[model samples]
Target: MAERRANVWLAAWRRAVLDRLPRNREDAPWLWILAAQAEADLSLARRMAIVEVLRDGRPHPAPDLQAAVEDRLGEGCFGAQVEQTLEADITSLRAWSIRIGCSDTPGVGGYYLKDPIVKAMDKPGYEEHPNPMQAQIYRSMGDARKMRSMFEMFEFALHQVGIGTRLRHPDWDDEQVEAEVRRLVTGIEPTMG
Candidate 1:
């Protein structure tokens, strides 16, 4: 019976990790939180704080690791990026957390696990039009070509949103630009919907 229970927990943990992939791919901050929370040594409260910070700000570059450590542990510690910590590495973190009695199940677990945070982050990106102009610019670009390559679509989307510069090439024909816009809009609409 004990062996069966252990197997069940392991299976559940695998599923939970797998489920986190889509959200991790979409929202960078959520990914950082999941990676950070996976650290076994860090308490759940600390993990939550890290997630909040990442969601609101930029990723910590190597030079900024000291400040990040100070923010998390308060001004005086030692370490690398949070992800490099032994507590954040998967195999060690998972086993250690289990050993220390953090529940494998969702919600009941002491630390906020990856799945919920990912799901919650997923909600706003799709539902709320936080940046309507950006969304509109992407919408203007026709779809088929953009769908063919996400990189192209992303670049087109940014361009329409008036990012980087007013226009990189001032001499380009208006008809050509309009056609490109139409193409992106048509392409992205189906996917965005």
Candidate 2:
């Protein structure tokens, strides 16, 4: 019982950390658990290690990140369907980012990434749509500086927050992404918005 209580407390703490991050308003308790698992399995000191590496200017390689996940969270981190769902979620977000000409940086700044991802995730059809690889490239174009700060902020928000992968891409559309970008950039081409 004590052990279970401790686990619950830990999870809550993790959630608090992630909540503090910018634009991390969504609840993802699984992220906190994943952080614990990753740390336990890989000897990572904190949950932010994953973001640290990516934000530190290293390539945002999914395979490498997968390896880390596998090492830390074990093989069952996600079943096939869940994995596919996340893939689609990411794919849709990437597609929307491209449709609106957002940076494909490894770490796009809060300036762009937040609204697009949030708004895109709220769109329809993005839940199951798998975009082409070109979408993937455009989604990860942030330079070291942009990504590092973004990652740092994300890490801070998700510090101890549970890790979760949402199955639904509710906000998955280019129109929203484009609109948000236009709103952020001042004096930019009205057509671009």
Candidate 3:
């Protein structure tokens, strides 16, 4: 059932992407590949938005949370299926080991993170400690900066992994190296031939 729902969402997402693409770009063989990557990024962003909305650890009503996600994702991103998309996002987050609590009462109660992930800065360490003013400055940079920084960090990490993979397998071609990197990053083993 979940797989069927995912396929439905995937088809809808592909249609949306195709609708936005220029006629010239529509015939490109890589169009579907690009669409898949865009869908992955969108799914990640949606999950991140959900985590941010629930980060306060307070139970937020369903409608309010849905609206917050829509706002975070910008206008028209969710079409008319925002609620279903939000539920799927929540499920994806849970699959990644995030614990989200939904209210027993349908639509009225709320949702919250059972255990919010703490930032490294918040943890006690032997490194340099920021002054109270500096901490305030850091906090004031806002969500956009935070999200961008996270993406940059993620990209750098992936690049490093790719480099390491290439170094370790010097004889491998680019496709072989990329497959290894993908397997390592995603933990999905390649099928035995």
What's the CA error at residue 97 for candidate 1, in Å? 9.6
Q: What is the C-alpha lDDT of each candidate?
A: 0.44, 0.44, 0.72
lDDT digits (tens) for residues 1-193 of candidate 1? 4234333433454356556676554445654455445343334423333443334223334324334434544432334454454245333434545322224453223322342232336456565656888777768877874576687766677567432222754665765555445544554322222
Clashes of 3: 0
What's every prediction's RMSD, in angstroms?
19.3, 20.1, 20.3
For all candidates, the clash counts are 15, 34, 0
**Model 2: runs farther than 4 Å from truth?**
1-54, 81-86, 92-193
Q: Give model 2's clash tally.
A: 34
Give the CA lDDT, 0 to 100, for residue 159 in model 2.
32
The digit string of per-residue lDDT tens for model 2 on 83-105 reads 46334434554564522222346
**lDDT for 29 (candidate 1):** 60
Task: Estimate the overall C-alpha local distance difference test score of candidate 1.
Answer: 0.44
